[model samples]
Target chain A: MTKALWRRPEGMSVVFILLSGLILVFIFAPLLKTVTSSGPGTLWGTLLEQDVYTSILLTIYAAFIATLVGLFLGVPLAYILARRSFWGKGFLEGLIDIPIVIPHSAAGIALLFVFGQQFLFGRIFHGLGVDFVNTVAGVVIAMMFVSLPFLIDSAKDGFRGVDVRLEKVARTLGASAWQSFLRVSLPLAWRNIFSGSVMMWARGMSEFGAVLILAYHVPFMGHYPVADSILVADRFASFGLDSARPVTVLVILISLITFITLRTIACRGVRT
Target chain B: MIKIRALKVNLGDFWLEDINLDIEEGEYFIILGPTGAGKTVLLEALAGLYPISQGEIWSDGREISHLYPEKRGMGIVYQDQALFPHLSVKDNIAFGLKFMSYPREKVRERVDDMVGLLKISHLVERNPSTLSGGERQKVALARALATDPRVLLLDEPLSALDPETKEGLQGELRELHHRVKVTVIHVTHDFEEAVALGNRVAVLNEGQIVQVGTPDEVLRRPKSEFVAHFALSRNILSGRAGDGEDGYTMVDVGGIEIRAITELRDEVHLSLRPEDILISRQPLHSSARNSLSGVVADIIPRGAVIYVTVSLPLELTCLITRQSLEDLELRRGMKVWVTFKAGAVHVF
Candidate 1:
């Protein structure tokens, strides 16, 4: 049988192709079964319960606010980083990626230090009566800090996708700098920016540590707080570590749908 | 009228210095320069895309050095046919007429007229990228013309097209300028395109205006060495001065004498375009001032233009017409007398 397979030239390459295919199937089947069984309705009634619904809704809303800020703020920063030349630019780029590299528990403690009522920014927000230390706004700020670079870097790639010649031609035809940018540069770069926003929102929705540090009481009340949050000034922060946060489960579902939809529409990944 | 004085720019690899010239109202001015000589930069500066470090540009008696491109009242077409890809040919032609200062309703009328003038009416609704190279060039030219700009600057406009298309568009360009009477400054490298379309030619080399005059004067009489070679003169000879009437000098060619007029030096260089020289198998009595006997070295056929090189005793090359080919029974190694008028022998 081995001699017969080798003797036929066209039949030889087919055996190795099937072997690699069988290996991929061997690796993926059990992993897929584990995920499929643990999905929304299968494990517990937390999937459709009212308390679960509230946690899921709050996560989505907070993620949305952070993503909106990322869309307007991070995109322009990303585009500038991609297009312009300046001293200390590499340092600035490294700063944007800092949140991704830091430990999540450490990120939570960092968020509390600056956002506590004793801090200057916390006092300013306290005067506005919109509390950041224990509200949805605190949750969003935490998500924004961790997930912003994804939005900006992706948007920068989008803006760089447009040809500079098209803008030059527009200028010669009487289009001003801002006018040319709005007309020639923006429309061509829209899709990539949209995909970047989707990715940022998905990342933000899945954030738990920073939000737990700043606003643990929103999800847990006077329970055993996570050890790091207990060290912070915020009360009841110890409850988070063992509280079984429902928002994480809801965030996972929303992100799964979002990932599928965006991947289909974005078609190609943003090129750096 | 368009006038540029001492235009200078140092754009790294490409440089231009001391470029100076003026085209009268309704004149077709062509600037001929090789690639990377800052020709496009000069045109772009006039159109206000780049800052001219030192120079003054005037259009219609107004100094427009500091004005905006649209305010400068100039239209420029690039070699790439840089039409707006998103717009139809009709809209591309009408693109510039929508400034807050310009009339919107008047745009359509002008676009229609210019498109019809360029005979691109059928392509009015087509996207610019869909059009052929020739069609795109006409659209670009039409777009530039539609605004009724003070002057039109074409940067190597036809050099991008096929031969047949370039010649056809060349004729259309001459007619377009004649009918519109818009002062034009066309930049090109093709000598025939320059001669065919230029009311005046400015020969640019290494960033300087080497020579500028009417087609007959510049082609027949170039002032510099590079200009003589670039205009593709057949023979440039050194001769000791010989005296003639009307302050003309009879230049001493080796073993033969030819007469020409000059305001130049005693040791002068005489330029003769290949087409100006006539070839005959037998030496004959003629009105031409000087004739020399030589052997035919080679025959070169250049599309509608035939180059017959007659190897004179002093390695002289004479260009004759295709129609005169059979009349003179010209062939390689055939002994012939290359005859040219003394006045036609330009000394500079």
Candidate 2:
């Protein structure tokens, strides 16, 4: 490391190295401190606790479902945004990103207006015996609301990178428009979509303010309640740092394992 | 045979208006033009990839103007060789066949045949990203040809390749065209490629079909100034035609009289190919009726060939081999004799 640093130009390297080191320390120091503060016994105990594991699983599962919903709705919009030109297209694209720019609590309030029990849509869904208030469905809706932009933007970039001529070539070769998209464009854009899904999923997992307003207690699958982030916050407030730190470490560990595995799978067949 | 009558397309800023063409069956037709001349646009229109704003297209005596590209029964190869990056070479070739719902065995047979024909059997299992440019081009061609479409449209397919790979593919294309007998409409900005591969060539300039004729006619007898410029006809001089001895016509071009073996009216336009002019130290007693002594004003080396511009009473450009440039010891300001046969002078 010393030899590599010495090989860099001395004058510019000093400032460059100093600034990069600052950023590196800024990000890593907090994470290192958090990991070291939690004891192994506490981590093991949190893992074995039924509520802790259930809440963590509920967060990931809700986020996964939200990502799946995003894939279904966002990919078509992404493709259209990438390939077509029309009036208000730029405005429409910007609209998709509004969830990201706005505060999550504000997003929850907006969603509550639409999904709240007294409102028209809320009453309609409530009549169907599917209530969003304090339910897993509400949790998914909140996650989807706040984390959808990552999937749509990444997918749009992926679709834009594909040459339109490739589709034309496919059409000329007796492949229909649908076939071309399935066999050529989708496979070509899969890596990006996968990465985008992972990002959306991670963002959804970390969501607190929106999920808190939307669904603090998830009556998940008509069974035991699961509330990961809110439970951690409650524990920190009432039972102090030791009680919450173990759950925080557990969430980080599970997220890292899941994120790394999905990333490895997503990396396959990616264009060089 | 394919006939395009008054076809017009509006693709945002660049548009083609009233474009007409007739590509005969089993003929290697070439669309010659410069970049942004709407050559690819015309080809795409023929393939039904783009909607024509007006007029119609009839292929094999049937109107297919509004058909979808997949139903048009045409294959196209783009300049960048857009092979599917996610698929192996064999899978890329087999892609079109999949939509046809052919049996597994038949698809394998056809894929193997194309792989064998293109000499890419070794690369069948390799992804397109791992292949070289020429390899990818061959795979793209194989994929397009696998469907056995009625007409093959090539959009500057050879422009991206190096000289050696291009030359090799050009020969392979010629051989494939002969053996397969598929109707081809190749679009290119390179005049030499058109001259080499085209039975009939169309010159497109700014979305209009300026001229369409055989390669010899397009090269030697361009009908418009655009064609003259696009064909790189350096010598386009207007002259007064006068009667010459022994049933020959003489044109006085800026006080320099050039002889041609043709009858002409009072005035004429002449085009002389630069490569046809022979440069020598002295005028020889040859059958060439025209000979002029001029001082070499400029010598520019373009790859293997050198363009020697001579300032006669009228300026003339002569293309000569690099070895000849050295053998004759030609340089700027040296006087040299340029000779050409009377038949070589194209009088219009």
Candidate 3:
């Protein structure tokens, strides 16, 4: 009977009801468990630890880098996607969206293969004294790869939402193509770009698998920047992870703040 | 001077097959066709907006088909007043001059002159959206004329406005054309608009110029049935010319004799304006030779004029004032005498 009520002719189905219900479950179930523990100390102590602080800081730093990277590479490409039509446009769009569809661990493995020892980029970079294995560069690359699609897709949709007629009129009025974009299309799509920034930052913060695979040895820390490049394969994992533990904790803490900001921006983007 | 010869362009489904026309300096010519007859495409082609498939267009004795719109030295105003929404009225007027590499002093001078001539100086700083329909029309005119175009192409600029506004705006545009003495090629489907604004009218049907002449020539003697209908012409009588005195022609129009002043070589076709016919109850004996007895069959009240159709053996259309219908006690099926001069009887 409830299903029937929700399912009117050409109506929203019971799946929406179940989806909202599941969200309510995920949000409340955790708080309910914490409440039953009879202590807020566990949560508070976990929050104040040095490793936690360091991880949170590293997350913010790396996410900030990822967001900035997304901006530089994503914006012009997005404008191209929105504005012009050329051969292989659909194929190019699908290529941009590949990172989003692939599993995160698979994405990590893929990055590792490309930037690892004995690979093209890996050998070239190693020749320049740049090591990708167990480093912060890998973390940022992973974050950027996973989060770039969001920024590009959002920015492209933003530019597409603007009317082409307005631009044409501007062109007739003696404004060049670049001038028209800056004056007409850019201001209109700014809100979408802003939302894309938040999404990019949040996506960067949550990127774990790719970071773990490629550059996990920057000693993810709050103040002390550790650069351990020991060449033993087993010692490699044990030493670098110890240094990155505090940084990981800091990442988790900072991610909470960014997640809230991203949620607010995304909700507003959808609403308006 | 503006000249277009055998302009052939295949713009998708609405191809302009062969359009040929010319306008003398300071002449007002209107190209008229129904909607989707490629009127806009023709105008844009002249303005260098579209590539000409096969044609030669000359403006001021220079061929400009290959030039860009900005380099073509022509200005255009569309039906939907495409004022740059971002700019003020002053800036909009200054737009054309800014391009074409005008100096700052000349741009300002030209803008001022045009704004004053169009009498839109008060609206200079205001946005286009804030202006009324008539005001925007004036601004569009000002902007188009600012750079002093060799040929001004107005594409149904009055189509979207209300009747009163359209009439007033066209009057203003007509006055502007005269004052500026610019070669204007205006396009509209409105017959009266063509007549009111055109010194020479070209009636286009399906992208072909069926007739091009003075309004009187086109109206008095239409080249074809389409041109006749397009002008809302009321005179069409199918009859066979019979043997008469050498110069004086006699034709039988549905058993009624019509005496025409001109000689007829073949079957007689009479083309007369409805306004030329004078209706009466009694047949008057005068120099006017053609007088036919008929009954008023239909009375259609158009705006400020009445289309009174008299059912003689041949249908005769007469234009009379609304007051005449009541004053003459005219009604459907009322017997009436339709008298018109032989000179007014057109032969083609």
Candidate 4:
């Protein structure tokens, strides 16, 4: 009788539905609680604050720039990882995922050694009128350092999914290597790359440890250097939990909306 | 015309060595080999897809062994029909023409011409993912031909299709070649396909060219033991050869003496095709030089033909129709007579 019940579709579906319901509730309960805890007036008031709005905008802009840079730099490496087999390939692949495994603050310190004012790259950029210490560039570099693995790994899987024969066929059809990549490989891998970019952007937005160590006050509006996470941390430290909650709720609401919008666009793009 | 001189390719685990061939202009040449025989590798080498460790490829009096695949002016079609899935059928057909820097109107005209030629007009607007296997292959062919390549390379283009579809495409390929008059280098393992399509067939074994001849020459007069086995000559016997009566060479197989028409003396290998051997219940009065009476040792039925193995001190498998099997009431352990003409025996 137990075996028969196990084989029944309704019995199996009931267990699946119950387990899935637990995960959905677990994910939504905290968001729902926080969103409802704040009054509408307080949420609107937080949204209207210049410091809050500007810092949120700054965070979004920095993450967007970081994502674009990651796309530009990571895709070629991803394609190479996907297509070629050589000595130390495994070591190189593991190196790409190192940021994900290490602590974010540790990752920040590691980034600092290279991008700090005293380092070679930092000194070079400093000489070029671009400063990395306590600047927007530092924030973007920190975000990119922590979240680039998502983009590279996803893009590598995307390129791996595309058959190499397609590229070979394109070559035979009078397309140069670069042309084939643009016409065939890139387009075929667009969906994965787009999703990876979104993931990297989202991860960059929520980053606190790395951003705090690298750029505590990211310059914005050509005046102040205050990022969203840094501002929220400051509010909580000085004015306590109630002062921090409104801005936190505002940031969450904006991020959730943007992420959903991007995800929906990706899904529609796949369908059509 | 294309000529390959001492072409050698080293693919680490698999390699092609000392390969030489002269493919004439406007000929449907076949590179025939079994699986893992490096047929695709040789074709890829010709198309400049693989780096040749040593060799020269001359096409139309121009050396092209070092040219890039795109600059070689050759198109290749694979068995899987690697059409760009992101593009529509029309776009896939026009992909190469776009790279050639043709004007928009010329590209449109060329795409239309290709679609009309391949009879894929209705499928022009559809995505490649939605097409059938045969339809996808047709689109791949059209895409390759749109560039007006000097030589067309086909890597087992019909091997992936169902038998009926394969036959239909084979006929279309012949017709297409005739209409387009493009020099084709088609690779396949099927002897029947080679015979039906190839102007001349080059048999490859273990990365080396074993024999190059017309299909009949390769099939009837295989120069090596590998070719004899690979060509499906089921009855191969190693024996001593000596002069016999009526200008025939008598081959001593074990204790059985079989007469063959050959000048090869001493030890020799003879191949007799199963279809050439006739089976009967009694000895027939005919001009066939060799006849042996034996008991039917085994009876195996394949698709439409049955293999009847007779033991006359040596096992000889002969192919007969199902109707013949039923008419003769042949069964295992039944006595039977096997006979074939001396001319049917091929000695090497």
Candidate 5:
């Protein structure tokens, strides 16, 4: 059976098999090397470090905050874009795609112009004792600015996949607009929205350029730490590949565990 | 009662213009049209799902042209049934009741009532995705009816089912309407379904209503050549009026003489429904004044009905029940008498 499965007549093309094998090896080799380069003891020791643990915690919580804010603002915009046609709709969709094309550094600079201390909205927030400069708000906003398109676009696709007739049926069934959305459209689009949220959260957690520019130093869980992306970069720059390899492997393992768990839940959600 | 006047709607390339309709209370009104005739658009406009460019809609002595759909007290069911996939059958049936603020126990009781009403008690715990197409349709109907809306809008609700399932659901729908007595506006392209369910029907073509009347009237007297071909699927023939005797006019159709009850001009078009003509081995003796001897050219069985083509110099298609065809022992090249009342001929 194994011999017949590998035979040419089993329908695998030689060229496709060769090219796919090459690409898979190219992608997996680096990940495998990184994981094995550092001993399991060294990775465990790094995870036990208070500063390293706090940095990872800060990155996750900041990304989580950013994702929650993204849901409040992005999901409605996605629903509107999916359901209605109005003037400038084409231009608005183009604007949503603009963030993905621009450099992350440029995006950070643009956010700084609107959110820096001297700006009007920034000063108003400053008066309320909520500062963005080197604060958690700064990290969240910077991450949200860079990662929101994933949430909005994915949610829009999810909403578009739902039949408009379903919403109309809800409306005629004595459900108000908000009720219909909460009861019908939201549940049907939930799996895609959830997957998109996970992507946005993961992307925000690994954000480097924006967080480095906006908030590089902060007291996270009583330890002065930056985002994990910045810490990894700084360690790589200062100590070279040999010293930074363990932290990189640790981060990859943590991301993989979370991604797998959440993705499994999302896939299961769509079926049941 | 529901009335629409001068209703005009524009949805990109498709548009409905100068539409007017009056539906009696508790009547099962069918909007019959082929695809892209704007039947769904008109129904949606009436349901307040789509905004109309121009028109006033009045229901029950109140003008509700701009009222929101939820406030209008109407329910709509799509062809695919559009049941909430995430919800169980019981929860789906209870969805609209949540908006109505019914107590939890009352909601459950009402859901049970609807479940029983639709004969879907066994499916309460099942997911909509797990149900069969007919079961999904029943669940959708139950959900729509749970709120007890003043009017129900059905857009080809049975079009997606198999033949046997569709027939079963059609009977169920008729029974449901008879028991509930809610005003319904059903949209469909199937003329047989329209005839079976509609108390009155409006024939729509190319974004306009061609005619509106009782099913008997619309099927018996189609106003235009389009309706003659589309709505009734009648056999039409062009002929000239030659002479008259008593209350009938003799029409010369392709060298064959036929009598008609309507007053005739020099040139006229005639429509005769296939089912109105009866076939017999010998000449039919009765009040039918138009009997012609013709040879059976073909016999085509369509489900329970058969379309028999008889060539009486001018070939005409006549419909007969398969049982009658078998009883008459109809066969190709057999000589038969085709008889129809002169009044059955519609002049256009």
Candidate 6:
């Protein structure tokens, strides 16, 4: 009886495996079907198209610029959130996370109110010869506003993991506040910050709703500013599913390859 | 020299209140306390890590109450050995020197000197994560001392080590202090550690300094009941005191009358060190003022010594050697005589 019981599969384990397998299939089936549906010639033709390739490059470039902006502005805020306790700290954290929970298009509308030509900030930037409506800068701002929380939250967790005593020791060793942060805290938290930047970059590249509302045609090659998501949507809307399928497949393939490479680099960076 | 006058710090739930100390140059001073006694807080305050709510800290006649920690000329090492994980051990030792005006070669020389002095030269190339507890602590010490701060603050630097490792590091710390002649402020909850390392020890209870004196003075005559208990005096009894013959005050503990040399009267607490009491088969004529015959309650064998509790209506613990315990064949319920001199009793 004991031998038979040991040989039998546990009910819970079987059930768990079945449930997990179902989710895996649910996630991978559509992606595999979409890639396989397009032939190699069609994918190559889609990549060869000037509009398709330029839009893809524009999307990647805009996301990179947005990530740089996030790093410049978000790291200090992350450090503060991790280290110091003050009034309204919780409220401030909640405010940072509001973009993650709210609808991206709604967020874009909110951004437009602040950065539009008639608004206060928009007027100030306009004085500097920068216009937000239907520009590359608008696309970057939209991407950054939606994807900043990933970088900030990850960096905050990293900084929080460091022992405060290390900084105190550094201060006693003749390091100023900034020196200690640069030498000790920053080096220790670089991995988290790096991975977070990657996450923000990836999120920015895939952003559609916010970019659609903020800048449908972001200037790229020559005088035309066209976005990848907008082009795909336009093709589908004008020429149906069959016409847009190749470009969609090309975009997915490029994004997956870039995202996987970055993720691998991040994992290796953490290991070392 | 360092002097702290009326130093007060408020850390929300914990507060160090009205702390005062005068540490001499090159002196090995210890801050002794129980857990949550605000000992580390006091050390951090001295290091200028915490803002002083009220008080003055003067170093070499300069008031540094509001100075930044980096300007205070003090180096602190924590028990956790907070070595930067990303930096190699050599870089960790050379970390502070880089911030100084020293040239690159000078920084390297200073790092080398510290490594040699701490005998961590072999481990200099290794990561702190790969080091043993003792090695990590040595590296921490080397890192702290490389900057040549005027004062060295060690917060339970040896508490996390095993007994053998702790003993080795304790010797190294003493030798290092002798060689460098920097004023050291060490904090620990272990009374034995304070006695072993400190030239002068200060006892902290709650948030206040209860007593400050030499190790002998603190051990022989603790000023407060809390100190007495913390110092490992096992027999603390509450009683009523009255005038007795020969200038000896008698205390009535439970139903027993114990004689002690004190001017205190009325209700009092008495601290009697276990080692001060003599346990024997029979009472003999001695210079001791108190002798009571009682039944042996328990015989607890600690390392090197045996603790025998005797109940003369009120139980009192006395320390005896293992040989004596065996030769006397002491067991539970055996009648024994416990005696101590009136001078051995500490009344508070």
lDDT of 2 by residue, B1-348 (tens): 999898899976877988888888999999998888888888988898877799899999999998999998899999989898767888889989988989999999999988888888899999888988789889998998999889989999999999999999999999889988999999999999999899999998888889999999998888866688788889887899999888889888988999986667677888888988999989877999999999999999999999999999688899999999999999889989999988888887
In candidate 2 the C-alpha lDDT for residue B26 amounts to 97
DockQ of 4: 0.79
Point out where model 2 deviates above 4 Å. A1-11, A44-51, A127-129, A221-226, A268-272, B239-252, B257-268, B276-293, B299-306, B320-343
Encode model 4's per-residue lDDT on B65-163: one tens digit a residue.
Answer: 989999998999999999899899999999999888999999999999999999999999999889998999999999999999999999999999999
Q: Which residues of candidate 1, in runs, are more than 4 Å off?
A: A1-31, A49-67, A74-163, A199-253, A266-272, B101-111, B238-258, B321-323, B326-331
Q: If both were scored by TM-score, which would come out higher, candidate 2 or candidate 5?
A: 5
lDDT tens per residue, model 1, B1-348: 878888887776656888788889999998887877677887888888778889888888888888876577778888888887767889888776665355666777777788889999999999987999999999988877776778888999999999989889999898888899998889998887999999889887777788889887778778876788778886888887767765667777775677776655567787887777777877768887777888988888876667877777676666656777767777789888888887787787
C-alpha lDDT of residue B299 in model 5: 87
* Regions of candidate 6 where Cα sits further than 4 Å from its true position: A1-9, A269-272
Q: How displaced is residue A40 in candidate 4, in Å?
A: 2.5
* DockQ: the better of candidates 3 and 4: 4
Score every model by TM-score.
0.78, 0.90, 0.73, 0.95, 0.91, 0.96
lDDT of 4 by residue, A74-152 (tens): 9999999999999999999999999999999898888889888899998898899988778888889889998999999
Give the per-residue lDDT digits (tens) of candidate 3, residues A223-270.
433211111122337676444333333333455566787677655635
Clashes of 6: 2
- Winner by TM-score between candidate 5 and candidate 1: 5
Candidate 3, residue A102: lDDT: 89
Best by TM-score: 6
**Can you list each candidate's DockQ?**
0.32, 0.72, 0.19, 0.79, 0.80, 0.89
Residues A14-33 of candidate 6 have per-residue lDDT tens digits of 99999999999999999999
Give the winner by DockQ: 1 or 3: 1
In TM-score terms, candidate 6 sits at: 0.96
